[model samples]
Target chain A: MAYIKLDREKCKGCMLCISVCPKGQLKEDKGLNKKGIRPVRFLDKDCSGCAFCAIICPDCCIEVYK
Target chain B: MKKIFGRTRSLRGVDTHYCQGCGHGVVHRLIAEVIDELNIREITIGVTPVGCAVVAYDYWDFDCVESAHGRGLAVATAIKRLQPDKIVFTYQGDGDLAAIGTAETIHAANRGENLTVVFINNTVYGMTGGQMAPTTLIGQKTATSPLGRNEKTEGYPLRISELLAQLQGVYSVERSSTDSVQGILKTKNAIKAAFKNQMENKGFSLVEVLSACPTYWVLSPVESLDWIKNTMSKVFPPGRIK
Candidate 1:
C-alpha cells in the first residue's frame, strides 16, 4: 500500500496537491492548521503512489511513499 | 515502505517566507533537488537578485551572494571567472532580468560566462505589488497597466530567452513552466540541464521558468497555474530556444 505524509505545520493550504491527486484521496480538512489555514487530509484510500501531489505542492508539505 | 518523494538536503529545514502556493518555493525545491542529485551543494554558489526571491539564501543551504537589482548575472560572471572550479548560478526575476538588468544579462551571455541562470518570469512584479513587468503579456493587466498592457506604448513582452539564445556565447536556453505536474517535471529537468551544462563548462546556460503570481494576478494558486498553462503559454511558449 502507498501512503503520503503531510507536514501539517508547513502546509499553507494552497490545495495544489488536491487538484493533481489522481486518486482523489485528499480533501480540505474542516479544522485549521497551526497557520490557521485549512490543510488537506488524505482519505487513506488506495493510493497509486503517483507522487503527482507531492510534485505539485508548492510548500513541499507532502511526502509520498509506495 | 519505499520513500518515493521528500525534501532535499540542499534546502534548509525551515519555512520559506513566500506566500501560500507561491511558485518561488516550488522552484526553490527543484533547484535544491537538482543540487542534491548532482552532489554539487558544496561547490555550487548561487547569486540572488533584488526581487521577491531576494532572501533566497535563507532557503538554500548552499552559499549564496546578494547582487544589486538586475546585476545578478554580472555578479555570477565575476564569481565564475574568479573561481573556475566552483559552479556558479544566478536566480533572477523577470523585472530584474529583462527590464532593469537587460544589459547585464545580454553582456554576460555574450561573454560566454560558464554559469547557469534560473530566470523566473511571473509577468508581474510580486514583491512591490502587481506592476507590469517587461515580460508581461501585451494584453495582461497589472497595477501599472490597469487597463491592460497596450502594444502601442509598452511595445511587447520581451522574449529574453529567445534573444539570449540568438547570441553565440549562449550554449543553451529553455523556457519551461510550473503550471502542472508534467510542466513542473519538465521545469526540473530544464534546471538540471542548465546546471549540468555549467558543470561541463559549456558556457552560459539559462532556464527561464514561467512562474505564477497568484496574489498579484488576483487568482487562486490553482487558477493561476491554469492561467499559466492557458493564457501565458500562448505568448511565451515553453520550449528549447537554442
Candidate 2:
C-alpha cells in the first residue's frame, strides 16, 4: 500500500495528476481550497508508489510514501 | 513508511506564482531537485529571466540574480567567468531566450561558457499576454497572430536546441517536454545532464523544455498536455540535438 499526502493549499487543482496515476488513486474532492479550486484526494486501495503524480504535478503538492 | 516523493529541500515550501497547469512550476521543481541531488545549492548561482519566470529567484532557495529582458545569458556568462568554481545556470522563457536574447544566447554558447541554460519554450509570450514569439509555430494562433502565425510574415519557429547544437562551443543540447510523466522524467534527466556537463567544465549546455501555457493557450490542463504531445512535438520533436 502507498500513502499519498496532498498539500491542498498549495494545489491549484490542475487535475494533471489524475491522468497520470496508474492506480486511479486520485480524484477531485468536493470541497474547495482557499483559491476556490477543487483539490484532489487519494481514493484507491491499490497504489504502487509510482511517483508519477509527483513528477507530472506542476504544483509539487503531492507527496507519496511507501 | 518511507517518503518516496516529496518537495526538494532546495525549493521553498510556498506556492508558486505560476498559473494552474503552467509548466514553470514543474521545471522549477526539477531544477531544485537536481540542485539538491548534486549538493550544489550552496554554490549554485541562478540567473532569472524577464518573462513568466522573472521572479524565479523567489521559489528556489539559492543565490539568484534577476537579469533584464533577454539578458540572462550575458549575466550568467559574467558570473560563471568571475567564479569559475561556482555552478551557474540561467532560467529563461521562449520570449526571453529565443527572441530578444537570441544574440546573447548564441554568442555565449559559441564562446563555450561553462554554464547551464534551462530554456522554457512555451511558443508564446506568456507574461505579455500571449503574443506570438520567435518560437511560436507557423500555424499557431496567439494574441498578436489571431489568424495563426503566418509563415510569410512570422518566418519559422526558432529551433534553439538544434541551432545551438551546431555551434562548436556548445557541448550538449537537448529538447524535452513537461507534457507527460515520461516527458517530465526525460526533461529532468536532460536538466541533470546539462548541470553535470557544466560541473565537468564541458563548455555550454542547454536543455530546451517544451512547456505549456494553459492560460494563454485557452485549453484545459489535460488538453494542453495532449496538444503538446500530439501537436507541439510534431514541430519540435523531443530528443538530443548534440
Candidate 3:
C-alpha cells in the first residue's frame, strides 16, 4: 500500500504534483475536481512514495502515509 | 518609487546616509521588493543588525527589531517561535553574520527553526569603517588587513552558504551576487524561495547576497563590481548551494 492519496474534490489539477514527483507516480486522470482542475491518479505498482510531490504542492492536498 | 509591491511603504523617502558606491542600498531595495511581491509586509518581522544595515529598519516599513552586535539569530529565533504564523527574518552583513553572530546563526539553522535569513556578504566590514570581515577574500586590503590579508595567520574566509546548507533545518540555501543584472535576478529568486519555504512551515532558509564595499574597498562603483567578479567570486562562486 503506497502512502499517497489526493482528495479529488480539493485537487486543483495544476499538475504541480505530477511535475514535482521525483518518481513519475502521479498523472492526470479523466476526471476534474470541483474547481475544474485535473485530479491526480496513481497506478498501483509505479509509486515509490518519495513524497517530493506532496511537499512541493502549494495546496496541502497530498497525503503520504510513510 | 515603486511600492515594492506595497512592502516598501515603510520607507519614508529620506536619502540614505550610506556612501556613494556602497552595496547596502541595493540589498535593502531587493528585500523590500521581495516582501512586497509576497504580500507579507504586515506579517513580516525583520531583525536589523548593528552593521551598515543597522538603519535598514528605518527604510523598511514593517515591524523591525534591533539585535545586538551578534545576537540577531537569538532574537529572530524567539520571535519566530512565539509568532509561528508571522514571517520572521533577519537581515545581517558579514561582520554581523559571519563574525560576531556565528554561533547564534549556526545553532538556529542547526535546530531548523522556521525563519528566513538575508545575509549580506560584503568582503569588508562596512559599518566600522572597512575593517576585515569573516568573508574578506585573501590578498584583499582592508583597514585592518592593509597589507592584503595573509592566509597564514588570518585564516581562509568562511564560505557561509556551504556551511549553513549542511544543517538539517535548512530547507533552502543559495548564494548570489549583485555584481550583474543576471545575478540580481538570481538573488531575487533565492530570496523568494527562502520566504516561500518559511510560509509553508518548511524550516529555515538562508540567502547570501554577495555585496560590495566601494568606498572602503578603495574602488569606484564600477571598480567595486570588477573587484567582486575578479577576486571575491573566485573564492565563493555564486549559485544554489542547497
lDDT per residue as tens, model 2, A6-44: 898888999999989888989999999899989998885
The number of the candidate with the highest DockQ is: 2
Local distance difference test values of all predictions, in order: 0.93, 0.92, 0.77
**Tens-digit lDDT track of model 1 for B1-242:** 99989998998878888887889999999999999999999999999999899999999999999999999999998888899999999999999999999999999999998999999999999888989998889888899999999999988999999999989999999999999999999999999999999898888999999998899999999999999999999999999999
The per-residue C-alpha lDDT of model 1 at residue B171 equals 97
Instruction: Indicate the DockQ of the complex predicted as candidate 1.
Output: 0.90
Worst lDDT window (10 residues) for model 1 chain B? B12-21
DockQ, Cα level, model 2:
0.92
Better of 1 and 2 by lDDT: 1
For candidate 1, the per-residue lDDT at A44 reads 82
Question: Which residue pairs in candidate 1 have backbone atoms (N, alpha carbon, C) closer than 3 angstroms, thus clashing?
Answer: none
Model 2: lDDT of residue B110: 96
Ranking by DockQ: 2, 1, 3
Mind giving the per-residue lDDT tens digits that candidate 3 earns over B38-144? 99988999999998878888778889999998789899999988988899999998888888999999999999989899999988888888898878888888999
Model 1 error, position B133 (Å): 0.3
Worst 10-residue stretch by lDDT in candidate 1 chain A?
A: A55-64
